[model samples]
Target: MQKYTVLLLINFFLLLANYSSAAANDSFTLGVIADCQYAEQANKGTRYYTSCPDKLSTAVEQFNTLPLSGVLHLGDFIDRDFQNFTVLNTISSVLNTPLYHVLGNHEFSIDDSLKMRVPETLHMPARYYSFEINNWLFIALDGNDVSTYGWPKTSKRHKRNIALFNTKYKGHEDWNGAIGAKQLKWLERKLNTAQTQKQPVVLLSHFPIYPENNHNLWNAQEVLTLISQYSTVKAWFNGHNHVGNYAQKDGVHFVTFHAMLDTDSTAFSTIEFSPNQLVINGQGRQPSMVLPIN
Candidate 1:
């Protein structure tokens, strides 16, 4: 009986060791910032537009000290001026890891001629794309794909935006945009592939699709429905509402990060990803969270 008990204890320690090794192998950390909206403009309401460059510089400095896999900037890089992107770019150039950008409505608030240059200026591979890190799939979505301001007046997306605004989204905020049908189909395919591979998905966007708010995406319901069908989707991270919000439904986390442009203080976070959980270490105004992936 004593030998059997010793054997059981040995097995338990081995199991714990295996679990720890697996968790450590799959863990990685990423930096997150939203709405750094840099511009040489007067503060509008709570948004301190000019403070962005300095804040972003500081944030990058802090992020440089960390062992981060990457950093995701959830759009609104500039308030309006196309020139401001250059200033913000210089500040973020010091970041030690790869930087990802999501298309935001405010990114389109420039001259009609420069509208098409937004993606190129940001160095995005595509308006919507996906990448893998630590066996986890990260999908960056362009919520502005079908929006009133994101596309040129002659484009089909611009026309579709007008039709949706006039009919389906009459009461919604015009500043919020939608994921176009083509993009939705593409997302579906990606999710399907991820599902087949048993890979967990983390969606990155500039617009929120859950919690039923005015700042939510124009086609939030459709997006929600589509994502719900895929069990592999673990979380959706966004930033458009400066105040920030969080909600969980159907085991998916919907987190709207606080905007860096909202106040005099800063907002950003380091998200540590593990096999079964995500630990968010929020800085300044952002709140930390522990989300279980199971």
Candidate 2:
């Protein structure tokens, strides 16, 4: 509880100094990137992707040039590696701002034999975690692992909960996009804390949280129920779809963005916020769209 309490206290001050009530202005810039998907040394036949560290390096250069608050990568930072995670590690060091992430399917390509390799190359203190930024509780969730979930059904103490999930979401995407029971519990605690502070929540996950919105989380309904319980969740941002667009349910917004670099043709989104409204601007593409982040 001390850890949780201390985390809350830290965010309280951070949010006060960072968050704004000015309504999403054309200022207070942040970079929205995803699916950098860098692979080292592509084969002779593959023109769709090139193993270009400089491409990422260029992106870092762009980040450094821009006066931005931070960067959120929706995942797939690399196309390969477990034991030797060269691609992501290289990019992590190059970027000068705070980097936040969600897990793409590629990040979990490692086998248990090489399980020692982790998300740590980015220097994240915790893998699945949350933080407060500009009056928002941004949650970074891992969407590819569910077998290790410590849920009620999997935990034996809550057969009823397991039965409920089995009835609704069994056999979905082989059940990979799960929050598991433990993370859901942790989320509940976070939601309560955010609620008490009157802060809105934003979920940053590799997989989409809603069913009709996109690829759909393995346990989409389970997650939806959780979101419904929290009035503070302002939106969910994702990037596996590789196509830039928006999805909305009631007041919650979901934005699925395109990849960064992979074929010499990629995209990056710029999100500008002030106080109430947030605008996501898609760049380096034909006929870009600007979406309201509220």
Per-candidate total of colliding backbone pairs = 0, 7
| TM-score of every candidate relative to the true structure | 0.93, 0.76
The stretch of ten residues in a row with the least summed lDDT in candidate 1 is 152-161
Regions of model 1 farther than 4 Å from truth:
1-19
Candidate 2 Cα errors over 4 Å, as ranges: 1-27, 41-47, 147-170, 211-214, 261-263, 285-289
- Tens digit per residue, CA lDDT, model 1, 1-294: 999999999999999999999878899999999999888978989889888998999899999999999999998999898998999988888888999999999999998888999898998998999999988999999999877799888877688789988897787788998888899999999999999999999999999999999999888999999999989999999999999999999999999999999979899999999878989999999999999988
Error of 1 at 284 (Å): 0.9
Candidate 2, 1-294: lDDT as tens digits = 999999999999888756543333324767777777666555444223454455556667787888777888887776656633665566667677787877777665555444434566656666689876667778888775463322223344335445545765565554345666788888889889998898878889877875364467777778888888777888888877655557678678777777665345447766766546677766554124454544
Best by lDDT: 1
lDDT against the true structure, each candidate: 0.92, 0.66
